[model samples]
Target chain A: MHLTSVLVIGATVIALLVLAVYVIAVRTPEGKLDHVGGMRLVLWLGAIFPTVVLTALLLWALPAMRPLPHQSGDLRIQVQGEQFWWRLRYEDGNGPGVISANEVRVPVGRTVVFDVTATDVVHSFWIPGLGGKMDMIPGRINRLVVKADKPGIFRGVCAEFCGLSHALMAFDVIAMEPSAFDAWLASARGVPARADGRGAELFSANGCGACHTVKGTPHTAMIGPDLTRLGERRSLAAGTLPPTLESTAAFIRNASRFKPGARMPAYSAMPIEDATEIARWLRSADGEAGR
Target chain B: MNRDPLKWHERLRVSLWTLIVPPAVWAGHFLFSYLWASISCAKVGSFARFPTLFVAGTVVALAIILVSGWIAWKQQRMTGDPPPHESGTQIDRLRFIAKSTLLLAGLSFVAVLFSALPVAFLSDCR
Candidate 1:
């Protein structure tokens, strides 16, 4: 049976149960409402029967949901959900794995544990193809286990109704070959030069430091995405925008333009030359890590 | 219409829609978001919202509403009828059905449905 069909059938069963209670209610005697007998029967069936059934279902589901008792040696990824974007820090500790936004790539046929949390309002972490959904709440860490039976892209969204643009806040999961993943991670961590250019100058001149942070640089802001390796990420704007250079430039210049009510202010009204220069500087500064 | 015993469908309709729609919508929205996140991040986890409590509350409340409305509806239907209105025997029979059916079995089922819905749906038991 199709999965969705099961959901519908379950819902139908609930409806049927409710209907049964209503029918029983009409059978009660007039004026003298018995708090004990007639009501007790309906309440018991309505309440108790479902309790047992649901408890059984939950017991059945826990093992599949939790990590298997002997399961070990899996990969861990720290996934942080900010106001309107997703921040990823791989647990490798060797160096930063691809610091991309909205795009998650993992090796196929391995259990990946996602340590997820929200920096702002409650955001739910969900992936339909892999398993269920976990909430990313401030001050609370939720763990999600995902195993891609094969190499494919899975779609995910913020299950909680966050503030504005919540509908637009989405992401993707890419499961690929182990070698391909390692190669991508290597390229992602590669350092670029801190050459004297338009991007570097704007990095200091613009008020970008108030929200974003860059390691070993003057941009110490932690209110937004970490830019220590911004250029290395697959997607930009917390997965709201694609990872293309043009999209990154547009987001830097005017994030609200892409996602309305975005927290980031737009630099579109700034001098066109300045915007272009900043874009160019950031574009070149992509791989300047460890330089 | 058999005039021997009362019917409960009308009262149950109110319980079904009023108690069911709002929370069901909430669950639906949550489910949609989880599906989106899973696809985007390649991570699957249990949905963390307390939708079960909300749904259970709705069902329980609906049960209350159904009982109350059923009494009113039964009174209206049986008015001016031939049955003895003031006798305790009739009361006992009514109590038996409510105790046996609505309260015990019916309420229990609603609670069960509430908790089961999320997990069932989470597993794509849609």
Candidate 2:
């Protein structure tokens, strides 16, 4: 058994026995026994003893926790919790780093320290398969170090109850072998492929460039998510919808239909054919440039 | 400290030191240490601040507990002791209450110390 379990169970049993004795002794004939001496014994054994033991335990635990305030890891991932989605940035030691939204790709067998903060309300960042959750509070950064023992897809979510769309706020984390992760990162940094010029024109004509971004294109804005690799993402609308042509178009037309309180305004006024072409064009470049 | 005659019981009587001081000290330590550590961390961004605050809190809390314990001892000396047979009488009541409070204070002192222990072990404010 773990030392903590043994100590806790042992203490509980001893306390229960002491309580039984105290109850039984108190019920005895009044003045039949010396009160001061027995009460002193109770105070000594039941009160003082436990206090001393707990103090010792706490002393041990204190040192164990001391390293947290100072320790850090090699790989850093800055994750900012926004209104309902996550903004992920992978920083390569002292580098400007690459930015993505709603998804993170990390390498297996390496410690990735998360610099967690919030752009708006307080939220919690949790990758249950990786480790414990850390709060993402506005104006404050919390560091949480996590490592994946093996390659796998891990789901991350906002654990805090922040808003109406809190439960719907989620992300996907893909953990790859070291070399594969490196290769993916290399490709992820390249310019997005420009395939359908007509669709791109339609996207720009509707003012989509004001919020979303497509790398290597004229559509560059910081308000919403970067859509350079939108087609490649596993989910849309912050994990509210699967990455399908129809789903992407639906999300683009009206994100609130899938995720209530989504920040992106609906494009329902745009022509249906234009919206479909744009969604198709965007998703068609998902794995472009072999990213 | 004694302002109102009607609120006499709330006054810091040497007689009731064991009853009041330990819990008061414990609560004070908990609140003050947390507040101090938070403010210090926000301003300093230093890793060493929390442990220092907690260590100081433990020392101060222990001092308060010891003082209360001393008062209990003195009260015991004057009142003789908790009676072996007597259930009523001012001396008996005072002794009983004093002993009870001393025990509670001792336990509370340990609890207050325990509350500060986690900051010593934890590595981050996050």
Scanning candidate 2 chain A in windows of ten residues, the lowest lDDT window is A64-73
Question: Distance (Å) between predicted and true CA of B43, model 2?
Answer: 4.7
* Second chain alone, TM-score for each candidate: 0.28, 0.71
Q: Cα miss at A77, model 1 (Å)?
A: 1.4
Could you give the DockQ of candidate 2?
Answer: 0.50
Best by lDDT: 2
Worst 10 residues of 1 chain B by lDDT: B96-105
Model 1 Cα lDDT, one tens digit per residue, A191-210: 54545666666767788777
Across A109-224, the per-residue lDDT of candidate 2 in tens digits comes to 88788899998899999988777788999998888877788899999999999888999999999999989988877777777666866788888898999988888887789788
Query: Per-residue alpha-carbon lDDT of model 1 for B25-106, expressed as tens digits?
Result: 4355455444543543444333434455545554655555455445534433433423334345544344333323433334
